[model samples]
Target chain A: MADAKVIPFDDDRSRGGGAQRPVRRRPASGGRRKADAAAVRDAALSPLPGPQTGEAGPGPDAGPAAPAEPVRGARSAASGASGDAGGAGDAQQDGAPVTAAGETPVTADGGWDRRIAGGLAFLRRRITGDYEVDEFGYDAELTDHVLMSMLRPMYQKYFRVEVKGIENIPSEGGALVVANHSGTVPLDGLMLQVAVHDNHPADRHLRLLAADLVFMLPVVNELARKAGHTLACAEDAERLLQRGEVVGVMPEGFKGIGKPFSERYKLQRFGRGGFVSTALRAGVPIVPCSIVGAEEIYPMIGNAKTLARLLGFPYFPVTPTFPWLGPLGAVPLPTKWTIQFGEPIPTDGYPPEAAEDPMLMFNLTDQVREQIQHTLYKLLVQRRSVFF
Target chain B: MGKVVLVTGVARQLGGRLVRRIQRDPEVDRVIGVDAEGPGHHLGGAEFVRADIRRPAIARVLAEHAVDTVVHLDVTGTPLGAGGRTAVKETNVIGTMQLLGACQKSPTVKRLVIKSSTSVYGSAPRDPAVFTETTPPKSLPSGGFAKDAVEVEGYVRGFARRRPDVAVCVLRFANILGPCADSPLADFFSLPVMPTVFGYDPRLQFVHEDDVIDVLRIALHEPRRGTLNSGTFNIAGDGVLTLSQCSRRLGRPTLPLLLPAVTWVGSALRTVGFTDFSPEQIRLLTHGRVVSTVQMRETLGFRPKYTTAETFADFARSRGPGLLPPETLAEAVDRVAAALSIGVLDGAPVEDGGPAVTQTTHSSGQPG
Candidate 1:
């Protein structure tokens, strides 16, 4: 195996006010050099946090020896060469082929060693500094490469989602995606995100505005953040739209997700049209997204209200197979899915101040809800069977 | 050549250095340096006035100097030259109160530049994603220098209300990091082994001490008018670095302390000489704090030369290793003996019978 290259990320800036030092290029796969550089570089420029290691412990006389002066000047004086790669996101991106997966620059059209090397390089990039995430903690590289790869099979082969009106979504610019939320487990949202990214020619990522509960959980929160789901608030939506990113919102929130199997396809209140106002303010279009087949995924037959209350969940759903067949009951019914994106409701036509008018907001909200409900009824009539 | 500046706490590194910078500026005629004690470093040709700002006589110094511009750099998070917490509070709060009172009365004092800390925006769980200048902290600082800073800003606001003519520019600086900077945060980062709250990797922000000097100079030389000048602005380098990422980069491994016993970790570290891990800082470590610099760019018209990450990296660049591992030095005698004797052998009662706290001087593993 060849020794990886170590580059000084910011040679001049990390040197403090001192003159630039020589950039070390070790060829013997000095792996620690990268981690050391990464760790040290990051810390060298950081505000040395207080914990004045005064060289004297808590002895009666040691207190004064811990003068604030030595503590301030000591560590910074210790930095030197290690400071250059401090803040680079890819500093420790050495060793594992994980981070370099994005820019491997190697082809597989070769012998076994070449193939292994190419594979290693890709893995290295994937694990290291090769990925880019937005300020909201959404990793574009991961979603495009890893996440979509895993979900694409289900989106196309398993559930067989047939997306319509992909042309209705603008190729570029800030837009709001208001979709119906369903499927007892709410696979619809993830499917919708995949739908936009894979179906669209430009392949733009969707920033989903999720409820606070999603972020409150431990593992779910991290995955959700990396998947680009921010708090479902007007502020977050507006910011996303302002950044020219496509934002998806299911304003129905918990009500839409926890509703009984009977009222499955019914559209819940759009939460006072906050998404509409966000679109209006940003002067962007609102694409009404309708997903059919999700409601049947987990037919909500009953509710464990007491258990949900005790467990702090919005609602504990009891599907026909769930809670009775144990874990196997949890598997989603492979219902054929049809996702139809309707004509974009142009919020740009209204004045920016129109977002402020409650009457207008209510009317616009109703219009969107009516459009989605009407589409749901039409799609239901066109559908053949649940599993077909 | 127009602004006659009066700099408080000239004995400190930032204040002392700023005084020298002000003296070189062709924009000013006279610069008066005020401190309780004389400056440790030479201030070239700047006049020194030995006076305690906590005392009423500071008003006399302000009036006598005919100081048109006042730069308050005396507020500190840690009691460095000052004796204890009581003294730090007096210097920070009482000093700022008296100085503001003096500025209110001083008819010539038109511009007041206050060097504040972002600690005013207390680190709490429910804090906004990014705090603007106006967002109130979810939980106010209950103790430590953060509380003192919050109080100091309040007094400054009161002064601003009384003296509407004075263009007061309050800069809420993030943790100031530089080779020569001594802050509570500096001491924490410089520790041989960092003890982080378990399961938390709070984002940290910082302003280079050099940037701090520059921004103060900007506020002093060119004070913005109306609400822009009077309004408080958050000053920090762009972007942030998380705690674990920082520890990893610094070659310092972290001991994840359970949340409830965080204070105990502070005391344990203190016994081992890593002092100054206050409750407020612990909270900060638990949940990182970040502020927006949009106002600093648009209103204050100062773009930081270093981002938060860059400032930290520079600070890290100048630090000497707390303890060098035996393997790193090739010309050493018996590497095995050096390693076994100091560690991986019989553990002594920790250099001077202090508690055997986690001492990870350079146990960052092969970095691989």
Candidate 2:
């Protein structure tokens, strides 16, 4: 229950990089303070470092507390602190032999050593194909270690996303997260993914239902699949829910993301309420999520239809900086984001035949749409400024 | 009387393997292997008949043998022997039509087993993550082996409808991989350096060749079990491996080219007698295909022992070493892992020297 130490991104990296240096004064003197911090932080976060965390707590003060102990203890603790338990567990198993040999007196060198070992092990697994991908081509390991890390900086330091009502999502079983999609490039969907992953207590992954266009592109298609984004079809949605996965769907589609900035927070038509029917058929609850501030990131002032046609894009945005500024214009504004998950509407109460009832689908879609729209307005009023 | 079974495409490795396997089954009285030419490999005790399924002569052979069950394995995705694409199409489509036509007239033939490919559900951007047997393909195959499969399945359906008494079983298999796999995918992996589409890393699924033979053998005797009540089922290994993962596992370096360039390279490789990387294969590589085998397990009551990764691993072992040996790669990985654990100390520069010595010793211990 201890709060995670929120270190400034730059400070965290600088200290981490310094640990890889060959020369140091004395192991205990140089490493004591940071090692103590890591031990305390990780002990509470992960279970793999339990023994090591206990051992490491007193080592820094004792100075000569088992020369072989500190390095293994710190290494496991440091990696374990990264929120990747699998990698941390592997590091613990690997470091076991080194500790037994009592060969090295490497102190807080834990930070970089753990990273390098975890990275090398990851590379080995990838080359040897010693990994599992779900039937949806979702690589959980890659998403957890690589993709999440890559997106974390932007989600944390840049957007500073504040998630509210995350408990509305069930800790286990299938749930449909219907969020209003915005941001010209659809970066909201990714940030939303990160928000759900990092903030949720149970750490559930959101299997996003992406439009067909995402799969039509080359590199995008590959990354999309690895990141667990399947085609936004009823079959895929129903299947994911059936398998007890949290499926994320943006009913607004391109209309919400591609519309001019003037129409920012207005919810678009919820695509024939197909998602509602899918949820009903799967007998899961629908969690309506409203995201504010993503619309301000690109701020599309105009649309170049001809250029969009030429490039085969849905709409080419002539943002304040884009087209004229070229590649540099693509950089999004650092807007503060607030994503709130509303109370889940249970569809399990409906009869199985309710999925076929178009009238019910319409009413449910409208209810979800209105809840999201109301929350958006409420969030916008609460905010002092767009970028704050 | 024991069942009389006629197996087509026996000249191919899979066909020959299936024929021999069925011949050993006690329920089958006689197994007759039919093809345009005699099988180069042994077919155990099964009788060999040199009759192309594309011709009406197949009907005469079926009548003379009083064949009650026909196992069609002639649906080929690649050209065989001296035949070209046209020949493959003829063998797969026209051949299936003639065979089914003959079976329709033969009242004695009450059971038919068709070996189909999951490619019938063509890979496309809009495709569902996993395909069930009844899922309609998002995009029908435009041409080549996939189209031939579609046509063949169509003909089989018509034949089944015309003869309700006939129990037809269609086993749609994923790509097959094994030690003795002669599949196009096997050839693709055997290349010293595999060429892949630049930006696409498709998730590939494979069924072990042994699993395929086992399923076929079961399908051959399925009517007696009564579980094979003329149903179509998907047969694939449990897991999936991305194309990139497969190449890495094989220790084969990849040459990632543009989509158009991959097609050009494929044809060039075909012309050079290296491998037939067909258009259908190119699309598969672009948008990988995966089919659910739940029905194969629950309905057909079969489970593949080897997963997709395991099947590919078995095939990679048979291929020997590629540009980089897997053992050396594994050793390097271990060395790096050990060094990472031990190397990050105040004595870092000196620690670097230790791995250099250990690497040399590791390499010396390994054979070329």
Candidate 3:
């Protein structure tokens, strides 16, 4: 058995300093390295496996020349050999024959792992910075408080936010905040997060499910992460909910955020019950929140999909003057925001396999959407201002 | 150049005349008449739509007519102590709710003229001062006490808050009268006997029906976007006239009576069908009240075309041979006096300077 190659995980030497020692990479035969690379490709392409610890390896100071036990559970290496052998042998049951160069066969099929690694690298680049409390501070705790404090004046002076049924939000565990999305910029979600943390009894931090474009921006990606927003993916949603955190999602999605000003407060197309399925899988209650006043903030005049694609953004919103004037017009008018939380839709009664039932998921999603929509209309009528 | 206007409750006297006046207005495009009882035979030229507003479905019917402005004049509740006045709650409160709901759905409805009442202010103190838009009504235990005051205001306010783009104007009226007036004044004059003061003086305000129509027209043409107190004037013909003076002006003779005894006897007579005055009416009569209309005059540019004296004169002239003779007026007065002696009306304790009592003029009515 040959030792697997070791790669240094953290290479930002400035942060690690002099205390960090160099990691040793074991030199395998050409056939073996090729085999190991092929195995890594196979594992990367496979569906996410169940929780398993990585095989124990040699100490950090171990020499590259040292012979060690083959890394158990490195299924990728065996899968690669099986591929090279045209599926002749059971890669898991018996070690595949090594090539003449004494190294594992190297295949160019490790594209998915490289892409995922690249994404992770990109995330790291976006996050590493001296994010001070000046010019949009990035401290998660402080940012949460500041976002709320910034909204307090408008919430109090203009709109009387009557938050009902906040007890629906789970205290310790992950919960999905499935709220009606209004307004052009999804400011309702931002205000909702603030409302939950500032006004809810437990003051739980809400992890928002933002769009992919949000995480693709330079400064915005980092800020979103600090604010606890990840890509609005079911995987991330399930992960957060399973961890007992409050995950806020605007099921109305891009349609709700990009609705024309004429249909400003109306609920748009909900994305095929994805949020409901996610909640069902996680077995979390869906808190329905209806937000009034956010619709009037930017007032989406139209959308430019061509420009959005050209700029690598989702639905380029043409507010009063948003994209034309850039950041100047992008500033949302300080509208009085009233967010009311309706009774939670309990998914605890439904089994996790219920997510597989499309019809059931659709009906449940529609029910939630309708409740939020009706509540929004009622609240809008009750609200007294466009801008506080 | 008449602008098209739709007036609901057009079959009612005040609403009927309003439809006619709006139809005659050169600025009005046309008058669209809507009523539950259908258009009065005299309401010619104007297109009429028959719909009972108590039902929610009427909202959709009204929305289809493409009415540019709506003057809602239907009253659901009868006057205090009138049989089935409580039933009026459904029509006045729920009807208005339905009407406003319809207005929200209609894109053509740019202006809403709500015909509210000074009753929303409830009974006021004896200040001879005018009640303005800013005066908040006092809270009362009775359902009607707050129903007219709060529910109506809530509906209108809610509409304005939800739909700022729509221009909504509320006209809080005083007692309206004219040739077709069927108020207590007509009943009092027609009575052979009239009841007089027991211990306190009572002052009543009335706006001529013609003047009410005039104000509605002003609202239609001007379309002010806030609440306005309109058509509230002393019905005494000159200034604040005493209850006895009002009876005398109507050619009725009044007999002074004991307050408690009058109330008790009035109640007894009311049960016997000899009189309409309840013990409550007796109590209210003994307590003088007034509401200001200075804001209506200043903001809406309203000047009453007909004074109270002229209003009564016009009514008397219209009755012609059917008018109540002086001798008949005396007999009616006697019957009213006897009715007062019996307790028919039950009066609530009057507060002198409460929020409901204080009346505001034009200056106080201005929005901040």
Query: Whose lDDT is greatest here?
Result: 2
Local accuracy of candidate 1 as per-residue lDDT tens digits, A116-191:
3322333333322233344565755445434554565577556866666666778799889889998767689999
Looking at candidate 3, what is the lDDT of residue A83?
Answer: 50
Q: Put down candidate 1 lDDT per residue, B1-368, tens digits, no spaces.
A: 37789999898888989999889888899999999988889987999999999999999998887899999999987665647678988999999999998898889998999988898889754455567888788789999989999999999988988988888889999989999987877888788877777655566788998898888888887654531555789999888766654654554556776766878888776566456888898978766777888899988888999987678778777775434322232213224334433221121111111011111111121111
Order the candidates by lDDT, highest first: 2, 1, 3
- CAPRI band for model 3: incorrect
- Find the candidate with the highest TM-score and give its number: 2
Q: In candidate 3, what are the lDDT values of residues B1-368, reduced to their tens digit?
A: 34558787877677777776667667778777876676545775778778777777676666666677788877523342334545557677888888888888878777777777665555422111233466554422144423554577678889888877767777766555667775544554455556654433354555677777777777777535554433222221223333433454454445556656666766675566554454334533554344555566656656777754466556655644333244454344345434534211112111111111112211121111
Model 3 clash tally, residue pairs? 66
TM-score, candidate 2, is 0.84
Greater DockQ among 2 and 3 belongs to: 2
lDDT of each: 0.68, 0.77, 0.55
Candidate 2 stretches with Cα past 4 Å from truth are A1-107, B223-226, B340-368
Query: How many pairs collide in each candidate, listed in order?
Result: 62, 1, 66
> Candidate 3: misplaced stretches above 4 Å?
A1-388, B76-83, B124-130, B138-150, B223-238, B261-284, B313-368
Error of 3 at B279 (Å): 6.8
